[model samples]
Target chain A: MPAEPPVLEPQFATAEQQRSASVLGMWVFLATEVLLFGGIITAFLATRVFYPHEFERAAGRLNVLIGGINTVVLLASGLGMALAVHAAQKGQRWATLTWLGLTALLGLGFLGLKGYEYFADWRDGLVPRTDGFDPGDVTPGRLTLFMLFYFVLTGLHAVHLSVGLGLVSWLAVRVMRGELPRAGATVAEVVGLYWHFVDVVWIILLPVLYLSGHHEAADLHF
Target chain B: MTERTVSPVATVLTFAALVVLSLTTVGLSFLRMGPAGHLAVGLSIGALKAGLVALVFMHLVRSPGRTWLAAGLGLAWLSILVVLTLSDYLTRHVLPS
Candidate 1:
């Protein structure tokens, strides 16, 4: 009989049991998270049903190029996170740290790009009810509502990204200190679930917020 | 001896597929599909990308049935909320005075 790892509570007979319990707990939590964002998405859809043209026109004003770049940035971050989990499972502490560091860096880069995009939107007077508001052809009030959704959705996603950064940073430090090996790889894998959940949110947001608007089609030839 | 870890190559491949699909969705959005078609294409692709991340990057594919149940429950509830709400709003003839 091999000794159980420290991560195994007395309630669990084996490390594998402990890991499955923890992972299942995370999934349960994520299910609630899906609804947290789902409510807002449902509301957005309902609003669109009433003002489809205005919403589409409002969406057109968004910067799709920047959104596309951010999507790629987020996807790259997911890749780093996945690799980090792989390294952690292999018990390669330094490799785990390296990959996790890369993940956090990419996450920060995504935030930077998001900040710049927000600033550009501010400059374009996209913020509703501001003195320099630009409503384009869309009704100002309805456009404001659309922009409201944009800010709220992206802002919520940004908050999640920041939380993920904190989590990844903490994981990296633990990896460097050789603390995570004692617990096996469950901690890192759990954190990866949260990180990838955030990425999934952004993946959904990109199309709804950035691509739905009928702004001029992006010229791919360039 | 019993860890179920995804390969780095497989992770990289999944990332590549996600990126390519994203670009394809963006390109498809430019095709002047009417609003319904446009949204359907973009959202369908978005769902696809999200599924990839959940399954591969999050390692849900190898996860236990309990985890799948938890995840599925969330989506099932979301569907109930969305469908019920849409049905109510879409079928309503007029607002109360």
Candidate 2:
């Protein structure tokens, strides 16, 4: 009789099963991440509903140019991360590291742009304290609250981006040493999950912050 | 032997979808819809774009159905949290006046 492989030996299984397990596990982890981002979104929604005019007025003053450029920058960084994964899968280690480094640079550019935006916000009296802002036609309490949410949510996102950059940097080192794990796509797969989630947050932010001003300030919302 | 191919075509398609969704949402903003319309359009386009990213680039659709199950359940739980918590917050200041 021919020898049979043991049941516990995953090496004997087809690639399809391995890929499926990785996907499922990654999804479960993503679910948890969704909740994290979801909380911030919920808070944003709640506050925005109660203070529509205040949010509209405050959001109108924001520089769409910065927001728009950051959006493109983030999207490109995400693309680079995706390509790095593809290169790693194809066993092009140098190509993978190069893409990773590009992604890191993009990420840094994003943070740098975001930093300038924040500084502008601070200088323009957009801070949350009742005394932090100038005399505009907004409810002082509500306007301050909107700025608070802006800082907390976007600031938290920046923190996550910083961590993501660090993760990619480490992955870049792995690629350099030719030690990119044979576990194949899981690392790229997981980081991609995080990257997409971050992008998703910005997707919501774009409308609420940048586009909210397009309509009348009194427009009722929830 | 197993093979791993870099799917430039699929990635390009996803990028196209992202761009389209972004444009669609922005165009919708110009329409004078009340708050409901704004919310509906923004969220709808956002959902579609996020779905594209998840499915094509993240390979959610290419993976096993179990992955969807895991993700869907989490989203469901999250919605419940949002609903219940918002219900409490909304009603807290109401009915007492």
Candidate 3:
């Protein structure tokens, strides 16, 4: 096979230089994303520290089965994305498309499960800031605060995942059309970085939101 | 680029590790640790999982120094925010409502 033409831009000295620059730029953007979610999480932690029991009680009401399933789904999606990038780097167009498709499907699966979880939360009256707000046995004020954090965190994450779905789909289309040549694999790599970062956020959230309160409820039960 | 690309075997192994760690987090949650203990352990495991994802799947292990700097800067700033904020809340006595 002939050497794939390099996709070097005007300013970049070489293809490798361009790839590094793109990766670095993505990292900087991801750094800002870290601060965005990090700030919210800090606020949640500060509140939890003050009202640990309340937070625990509120957290116990969360659907752990759904959360765990979503964790696996998102992680699988991340793996697919990594494989997609790997295939792209090797100039395997069909493999790249296949992995990207799988990644998007898994992402959609995560969102579908999340939507179901949200529906369950609504039916349980766990959602706050609305007319149907109910805190069950926990203090209304604290449960409301916890639910707010839960919604905001998960909702923001869902939005990001939706955007990721769009990006992955777009890339898949390009790959199918032969527009994204092997040299342009850096595009897939950068998108993979974002996908993995979102996965990282969900991983942190699993414990912070789901696992923190389960032991208390278990203690009461058994 | 070939050198930079993570082998399929390594990627699969990282995925398996993440799955096991996630299950462990769930399993640990069944133990009767108090709120503080639960939070500590949960977040600790979470941090570990996050580190794995960052180092391997995110390519930080093979990333350039500048990329590592960017990642480190994010964590450093997050620490500053959390520590400063917690210092105030954790030190204050909760007035009984």
**Candidates' DockQ values?**
0.74, 0.42, 0.70
lDDT, candidate 1, at A143: 78
Question: Where in model 2 is the C-alpha error above 4 Å?
Answer: A1-23, A215-222, B1-6, B23-36, B86-97
**Cα lDDT, all candidates:** 0.84, 0.72, 0.86
Q: Of all true interface contacts, what fraction is found in model 2?
A: 0.36
Measured against the true structure, the TM-scores of the candidates, in listed sequence, are 0.93, 0.83, 0.92
Residues A1-222 of candidate 3 have per-residue lDDT tens digits of: 344577668999988888888899999999999999999999999999878988888777788778888899999999999999988887888899999999999999999999988988888787875445555665687878998999999999999999999989888876776745555588899999999999999998988898888643333210
Q: Each model's fnat? A: 0.74, 0.36, 0.80
Candidate ordering by lDDT (highest first): 3, 1, 2
B-chain TM-score for every candidate: 0.88, 0.74, 0.90
Residue B26's lDDT in candidate 2: 63
Query: Candidate 2, which CAPRI tier?
Result: acceptable
| Tens digit of per-residue lDDT, candidate 1, span B1-97 | 4446778898999999999999898777666767767777889999999998988898778776777889889999999989999887766756553
Cα lDDT, model 1, residue A195: 95
What residue pairs clash in candidate 3, if any at all?
none
Task: Estimate candidate 1's alpha-carbon lDDT, on a 0 to 1 scale.
Answer: 0.84
Residue A81's lDDT in candidate 3: 95
